[model samples]
Target chain A: MQKWADNRAWFLILPVFLVVAFSAIIPLMTVVNYSVQDILGPGMSVFVGSEWYKEVLHNPRLHDALFRQLTFSFCVLAIEIPLGVGVALTLPRKKGVWASTCLVLLALPLLIPWNVVGTIWVMFSRPDIGLAGVTLNEIFHFPYNYTADPLHSWLTVLVMDVWHWTPLIVLLGYAGLQAIPEAYYQAAKIDGASRFAVFRYIQLPKMRGVLLIALLLRFMDSFMIYTEPFVLTGGGPGNSTTFLSQFLTRLAVGQFDVGPAAAFSLIYFLIVLLFCFVFYTTIVNLGKGEAQ
Target chain B: MRMKKRTVALLCYLIFLLLPIYWLVNMSFKTTDEILSVFNLLPENFTWANYAMIFTDPSWYTGYINSMKYVALNTIISLTVALPAAYGFSRYNFLGDKHMFFWLLTNKMAPPAVFLLPFFNFYQTVGLFDTSIAVALAHCLFNVPLAVWILEGFMSGVPKEIDETAFIDGYSFPRFFTTIFIPLIRAGIGVTAFFCFMFSWVELLLARTLTAVNAKPIAATMTRTVSASGMDWGGLAAAGVLTMIPGAIVIWFVRNYMAKGFALGRV
Candidate 1:
């Protein structure tokens, strides 16, 4: 794609600039203002600079939720990525109706509303009524109650997330797989490459761009997961499933602690930025150090 | 042996995928009383009372209408703003192109939780609270960047010669874009619209925050379940099932573009 050096192209970007500015900048400035002020009430606020930030930084609950959030994100990335790549590999490779059938079926869960995903899981995992709960209790003879046991609650959230979102990775991975031309595979076959060898050398390398997209998207989405977990666990049987977003929501909405919430949010933003920076740098290093 | 193993893996995955969905359907069929009273694989007494309640009750069904209104508005606004920005970004090297692009992506990266409070206050002050336009504009914080990225990718794929030739033929910029450029990237537009629709439709937090009653989203409406009767479990399940329909239909319509789009501009 050739790009002309035209400073006047700035004119074309004006609408997007105005819209995003109105939506993002004002609210962000509001957050920053609240972060440094003690909003006593409507039209009454004290300038309490850095007070909220310090308190939020030291809060034990924040630490707990941060740990839980990180663990959940790590688990999601670990499970979804490889599984998505593998599922993409396994999808019956062809075109037309059969292929689209597979794609649509896999994508169904991804398209459903997050709240509905939560609600469906809630209905499906009810101890006395749910198929899962019933099977675990009756057939498997394992006592499973998401609302009572912390472990059960955590596992249920993880399982629900995997159920709802793994298909997104799969679809992305499948697209990446589809983009690989036939010539490469044919060449691999001619060289007597085994299935694993061909995948390792050809498919993995070719899928890097889409895989990176999948990784970054999955990281951000999973990190900020709110509606599903909020609906499913209500942030817990005991705050076990309460991630950073849930904690932030609790601070801002439930407690109305605007200053702390805002400061906490800034930290949350920084942490996300930090993780993205790390991921980007590592990927860059990998690109520089190795051909693949 | 290889064939057997492959078939087994695929079947296992499919079963894992569909089981919870099947359970939700099973729940939708049963009455709330039956669901609580019995532990059964299939609904012993099937009922459409839940669905009937939704259709009969305007308050319940209006949530769907309100949601569609805002989502449609958001998608249209997102595409309109993103179109020219995408063209500009794709075709021209501006003074701060990289910085501008980064800023857009950063907004997309910003969590909605951070914006909920400020948005609530801002919308209230602006008198846009509980209106479809407010929520639609709020959604642009994220959707605009995504729309631009998707459209830019597609636009870059189109040859620059088309733009040059159209200009040489004495066509104005707006005319060439509307008639020629847009049609060429129609798939990109469809894909972008589908995404904008999905994200807006599914997001409850910001939508819930921005609206109280008149513009309430279906997802938010579903959560307002503590009525005179306890939880209304059957009704909730039925509503959840209904909510899945629109998204399913949209994906089915755009399944082809989705396959192409996912590899490119998709998150």
Candidate 2:
């Protein structure tokens, strides 16, 4: 794992730098530019200088979207992490036909196009024709309509997300579980360790690295979720499922409120960056601790 | 008892995962009228009309071609750039290397929605709008970083001695990388390419925003089915089923490596 001290390696990274910067930096600069100016026309713009920031900071809509986004991400991480690990535990360890089949099926949802996932769920959960919807309404005698009911819409989006993405967690958890040495289990058995004790001591500790990656990946992706919910609920049942990304798109692309939307974009970027910083540092420290 | 419980749990979760997909396939076979009126578990009157429509229609089939174009471009660009960058990170500790690696990763966290306005304007200014390349470049914002991360994991798995030995055998850097280093990590490259293709293929917001009439992705094209004439449930279901085909095929080839690849090879 020892690496040579070679600054010339920067040359090797130059291509990636150019590509990512072309995609990320120039647009970011434009967002920053738009945030400061109020455009009257194509070239006729005034330097508004923090007016948009002030308005966006106090905006109630932004507040609501941020709150909703937080709750959604929290629920995603809470449900997915444990469920993924639990399902992963049930997977067959020895490689064979069943194990391979289980893996392929588990990975199918993760590969589906995001909007298709939304569309599939729309058909699968519709009250009129959807299996879940009809079962709830006719079979179980419960009122379930994602289109007309706010609570139903929210639940639909949440469950849809769980179905679409929980496989990622399961895959990561299964990989982590696979990496644990057989000696650890043998040692646990020799020590007369209970199943709970073995899992707590051996499996959990060993899986920390991958579980952390899963946590951060799930958190960031769920925080930025737009496509599925946008397709499914269209940010409705009267804005119940509208999250931060959809809100920003509405302001910027839908309404052309460039100044406020640009400021809001900056704020949104910073919030994600803040969380990334926390997770990044933790991962780095974990590596360092392991090295020592 | 424990084996029975485990099998039951796995079966339940797998069933939960497959049911929606089954619904999509089932609906694809029924007529739109049948989808609305009948609540049958299976297609009452199975037909190939929906699949036929997709294959016969220019608008429907071109979307798939366009999607494939951009996804291919994005995967090639991502892997080409990420290869050396990943090698650099895996092999050397340069100035700002750690910081640069983390910085590259931060791009993966930037929400695509935030980039919509700026990208729309920026691409239009450069006249790259409505092109598959535009979508490909925009997707690089996320895909490149991920490729670098995953490829780094795989590259680091190869020992430093290989590089040194290759050099001692009178090989130039490029020759060594392509002939010696590449074939050694070809599996890693395949996995990285799969991740790149998967991420770029599944994305909608940027792909939809970047293209218009000429190079529209199938995912974007599928949106047109929701016209005022009510939904084309059968056709839409067929298109949805089609979108999953490429992923399913690619995942099958890489089935053994799925977990390790998802872990970015770190595990």
Candidate 3:
């Protein structure tokens, strides 16, 4: 089994490493430099140590936005995970034109641009002319203006995210479901397992890996959501829809506050890394348990 | 018996999924007056003016073309780089291989917004600001990791015995890869390309920040339409519908590979 090999294969990976580093690492280093200093103008800076970090941590705006972000991500996970699983369970297992049709239809929403999804929802929720707003008011006689009402604004944003992203979860879940061997189901049937028992024991355990990936992907994407809320509500009826990403953008681009925004970004990056690490470890341990 | 219930549930899901898309298509076909007049599933009067405006105008169509150019370029560049890297990782162990793989995956996790300001400055200093190339390169930061991860999964699934067999048959590495390995993982490449296209196509914030006028993507063009002369609903709807075409075509082509792509990290 031991064979001497020419090491030329390393050449294959060089182009990718170079591209990723040029695009990602160099810019990241620049951010780290900015985070540590006060940039008054071009070529003028004063070292501030952790001053920017302290300021960002204590800022009430950051606090509020972080809270909103946490809540929004949690809500997205709560709703989309179960909804996706339910939809996956319902998909026909056999391959045919029916399967093809379902696949295409489910993927339609995902293909639309994020900003366009926001625009569509914004127009769709207009009280005067939009379909959703008009129908809800006409049927129930309840006034709904997402632009003017904070609750409606949040609700609209949540519904829009769900509409755009739930298909991703379903697609992932379906893939996992498809990979399960028919023998497992046959065994369950012979054992006289009930529908609930089959799902609880076989399907759920089999899906844990894909479900974890779905959860983490949705969590990160939802946490970093900016364009949808930006276009839809413009981050408010009084800042009700301002998530952390929008808040960071407003600081860095809107006010041109380079130092604090850089620090804020680092903190934001760390939080995401921490969550991903936790998710990765937990799933790996679960996988090990299953292997055992 | 169980099949009947599954069919009913799928029908409901399909309706829920397609309703908004239907609404968009419906609005795209209507006159502004008709759109404003009432809420109906079907337009009172249908017109092609929206589509005409997008097709005829340079400002409108340019955004579409610019987006397509960068998206296509990004997909090509990402795959070309990722194919080799993924192959190397799957087939050989080298200096810092494990660490390098982890580092690449970590890059994918970094938030794009975090790097926006720095990227602006970096691209400007390097004479790449406001160009399609800059946008395309910025996208590679994330897409390459995804492509590598996905391709590696597929590559691992291909048995090592094939490689040994090819080598014993006097096939060079490149020839074997081109003739044997590539065909085996064609589905994986399709999936990787689909993801690269989808993410780059829909991305707005970086695409907006990097380009000012010449290379403005359609996603950025939406912002301008809002600020210019009274929210041109017709123009915006037209642009929205047109922007959807590339993505729809991509999904149509790769519909089969999606199940494999979605199963990515799980496998």
Candidate 4:
């Protein structure tokens, strides 16, 4: 290992640090300042200690939204992780036309804008005019009205998320899968290990690092889901789809209640940070354990 | 026998994945009346009116151009800053490096909803409100971290021996970076740029918050249509289809590098 003692490298990083700070940190400080006080208008705020935090914490709307957000995140991870791994396992390993087709198909959903995913589905499930809804009612008679029915709305949103994001998990899982050594599989075959045993012992452990990354990324994104459901349901049929992000948006933008909204956002930030720290530390510890 | 079952299951998964996209294309061809009346697999009365409306209207088509301008600008800005920062992190052991790396990532975790109000004020104060630059700069907050993280991983994979030899042969740092380092990580850069473009292109909240009328994204425009009229289903579908085209083109170009970049960043 070699060290470059000169301090010139710091200058190389200065521009990035400054850009990110200007774009991210300064505005965050402003949010913090707003969170602690009541803002009547621009620069017209008076100090109030923790009053907003108390209001945000005690609000039943936040409580319900938090529960819904957690359930949605957990459900997305549960579905996407396993489905992604399964898809990765089935994909052809060698470079060819088939491999290229699969890659293109998988990447398609990831590129579309979030609101468009919702719009597509909203049009897609229209009972009178949409394809899915009309097909279901006509063929299977399933009575799928996602906008009016809460359970149907939740299911539709979940399906839309899975459609849009599962490809990302598959892409990550495939990368991890491709990196496994041929020797490990060859040795497992020589030992007459069953496919299940081979996957459980060799492939699963090898994919642990990438899987953790996939999990954290999916969790964070799903937890902060806003545009998709906002477009799909408008948090309608009595707030069934109003997740935490929507709740925060309703406060900050819709109602313009700056104080509690800012406080609620900080708490939201802390929860996401708490989850990331836990997962990151766990992965780091696993790496250390493997090294030892 | 087991292999046959696995093949069937995989085929089923593929169909599940592609069905909705197939449906969108199917609906885009049908007239509003035909769509309302039929529950058939194929369009009964095919028409191009939806697409025609999208292409002909300046208001509709302009949103796509505006979105592309900001997304492209943001991608270029993010990559340029991130490449050097990624190199510095990968190649050098600078002071406060760990802290700086973590700081970069923290920006990504903060929800945009939290910063919406403050950002509006910040942009207004700085006289950047309603400009494409406001959205582009705000996008950098998340995209830069992503680009840096992915690029660093790719740079780390390239052998340090190459750098040592290049420097020993009297190649300047800039010369080595351009001639040797960049070519090796071209695939990595492509993948990073793709993700940046994808995220920035889809992002609506900050784009909506920062810009009101002049630089409104296509996503924001879709929301506005609902209020303007009683949900112009045909126009919205046309706009939705148009939105998918840029992403489709992007994926086609970078399809091969997708898995590798993802694996490296492990994101």
Candidate 5:
């Protein structure tokens, strides 16, 4: 649909602009202010331009955390996207008790508080008494302990994330599926298209929009994940599960290195923006290429 | 055979989803000793003491009220502002519209942990500290942008011809929006509200930081279980179970609408 050129439309947007600006800009400015200064007390502060930024940039821990954050986010997207779409495809489409029940069950994980999610998973994976831990050790005869083993810790965090967030993708994909007009399916049937062909042609293309939103949302959220991993592993066994947010939280809140923490925060925010920009443009350009 | 395969796959996935939840529920029904002592599929000594403690205690129950209060407030604010903003983005080629949209999302990208101190100071300075509205407004940092993004996708699906027709028929913009346009996208609104409620309800860091006592959220209150003594696994699990109730109720009310909501919006 072609949109009209209308500057008057700003009237409609002014409210949101004000609300977001009021909430976002002030705190942002504070972060920026702290990023450049050395604060000792309430009124004792010294200007330290670029000093904190340089220290944060060279920090070895930040580098490891950033690397881990990228890997975790990549793994999350790779696993959750396909798995969520597959689960959504199998969901009962017809509205009834079964469909409603599936929808409600799918939604349960998302509503739990982040800390509670971590706690639940923590108990659920305990080697002594937890189901997953006991089953793996006793029944499956696997040497798995998230607390002591870094690989297990990584796997545990990854699995925890998938369990927590995959529902979001399923919900989005299911909504996209629900939107496909009945006529499309009817037309496909009339043409005698194979199930795979119909899925490849009709369903996948229609789901592109929702899937894009899901991709961006999941990427950003996973990249910034903090509370769950913090609670689950305490960045565990030796900072193995620590992501970017937890790293920054340790610097800012734990160590109270205000300037460096603020500087690192800005860099962290930029990295996310850069990735989102790349994704938004790449997918959008791909769509344009297909259109052309 | 194919239909059976699909059913099996779905059931398997659902079982995977429910197992942890089942464990939480299982723990909730047992004593702390029972939870810690043995691996039980079902509670050995079924007790409602965890639930009983929460109901009898003011601290635990008030957390639920506080969470609900802010979540509801945030959802209402997000929708009210986002409705008009989304219409503008969908219908018009406004200046810097694309950039503005992207900029809005960057707020969502900001790590909440980093912003905690700033949010604490900002809210405290304006004297909105420890109020439900503080958390509600703080939540809008993310929820408003999300609401706009979702609503824009839905609004773009409504053909321009409908708006044109409404205008030609002498309906005022506000009246057309309220009477015709809103009903058409009620499902979208339902989905958006659900997202907003979910995000606000589950968030702990910002919610915990912004409010100390009067408006402390249930998620924040759950931290009380971790104090000096050993972990209160039963009580914590019980609170976790209770936190899910409000969101589940909201989802039930919006289930039908949500089934159809994502149909229009490109989002």
Candidate 6:
């Protein structure tokens, strides 16, 4: 919205700026300070130039974790997007008791605290006590132990994430669907347009805005996922479940490799920034190819 | 048959969602011995001791009180600050606005783990450590940006003419904002507040780090209970179920706003 030149708008923004700066900027400065200095005694330390960055870059564990992280994020997006859209499409349009019930039920996973989600999954996948594991192993004879099996652990985490997040996409897509006036559907029906045609031309196009947002949000979140998997696997099964943020936590907090962790954190932040730039551009530049 | 297919898909998904939660609930009611030893789908030997224990212990119940305090504090603080900032972005063409917006969002992008250590040292040095306000302010880092983002989206959809008309009618800026502007975007406020609450409530790392006893969250409390000689499974399970209740209640109250929020108030 263009308006008269009013630098005074910054006054309105001052409170937010102050609060965020207090919480974000100061801690960021500490991280930058820690990245350069090597602590030895109470105050004695050597100034390490880019030595920590060099060392962190060459670390094989980081390479492996980065690869796994990329794969996991890709898998999350690939699975969640289509599944969320499908569910959203299938959802009833009328705002009635049934729709609200579904909305509440669907939101249950998203509302639960992250650690509780981890706890639920950990308990539910326990072969000895969990109904899920026991049913899979004893009843269906499909053996699975997330603690012992690396692939199984990865798969379980993926399943848990999907269960937790797909509803969000559904909610967003359903909202988009709700925003579409009934006239368009009626027009489509009168024109003898097929269901797929109406979806492709009308619904999908209208939903694109919300879907793109949902996509970026899910990507950013899944890329930095930590708490649930940390609780579920503790980055175990030979570090198979250790994603980038978890790996960064291991370096920074677990081992107290502060210098290396700070360096790695900058690198990790850049990667997320790069992805955001690309996604932001794509969203802005959409519709050129499919304007028909 | 077509309608049934859609219903079935939703049913299957709902069942998948509820199963794990059901497992947690089932464990919460059973005795610790029953929970650890059996694979019962339903609690055959249900007990009330787990729920009773949480209510009886100051440490247990206080965890809930402490969490709610910080989360409520963060939500109120975030929305109060975010509303005007969102209006500024949505209504005006201020210099460097785009850059500042992205910079705000970067806080949301930064992993909480990266700030875990610095936050502790910073809060402690400032003498705010172990306080509910400490956790509340720390949560504002991410929540403020998000609150602003959602509110800005909603506010943009509102015509600028309304502001002009209100001004012409002799309402001061603040008066117009609260009386006329705010009620107009009440849905946006509801959505933004709901989100801020959801996020601050769920976050653990900073909350756990900032609080020693006075503000220790239920998530941290539950996590600690895992390291005993015999793990308090039932009690932990009760705490888990308890954590979900506030969120459930929130979703119920904001159910309609959520549809609009999901569509993103334009919150």
Q: Report the lDDT of model 5 for residue A189.
A: 98
- Kept native contacts, fraction for each prediction: 0.78, 0.88, 0.69, 0.68, 0.72, 0.77
User: Which lDDT values do the candidates have, in the order given?
Assistant: 0.87, 0.93, 0.87, 0.85, 0.88, 0.88
Error of 4 at A66 (Å): 0.8
Computed on C-alpha atoms, the DockQ of candidate 3 is 0.66
Q: Is candidate 4 or 6 superior in DockQ?
A: 6
> Candidate 4: lDDT of B65?
80
TM-score of chain B of 2: 0.98
lDDT of 6 by residue, B92-126 (tens): 87889878988898888888888887898899999
Question: Where is model 1 more than 4 Å wrong at Cα?
Answer: A277-292, B1-4, B226-230
lDDT of 3 by residue, B109-174 (tens): 888899899999999999999899999999998899989988988887888888999999999988
**What C-alpha root-mean-square deviation, in Å, does candidate 5 show against the real structure?**
2.2
Worst 10 residues of 2 chain A by lDDT: A283-292
Residue-level lDDT of model 2, residues A1-292, one tens digit each, is 8998999999999999999999999999999999999998988999999999999999998899999999999998899889998898899977899999999999999889899998999899999989999999998999999999999999899998899888998899889889988988898899999988987998888788888889889999999999899888899988899999999999998899999999999999999999989997997798678879
Candidate scoring better on lDDT of 2 and 6 = 2
Cα lDDT tens digits, model 3, A1-292, are 2222446766888999899999988998998999999988888999999999999999998999999999999999999999999999998888778887788888888888889998888778888778788888888899888999999999999999998999998899888888889999999999999999999998888788889988878888898999999989989999999998999999999999999999999999999888987886786588668767
Highest TM-score scorer: 2
lDDT score of residue A141 within candidate 1: 89
Total backbone clashes of model 2? 0
* Runs of candidate 6 exceeding 4 Å displacement: A284-292
The TM-score each candidate achieves on chain A is 0.95, 0.98, 0.94, 0.95, 0.92, 0.95
Residue clash pairs of candidate 1: none
Q: Model 3: which residue pairs collide? A: none
Pairs that collide in candidate 5 are none
RMSD in Å for model 6: 1.9
Q: After superposing candidate 4 on the true structure, give the runs of residues whose Cα lies further than 4 Å from its correct spot.
A: A1-7, A285-292
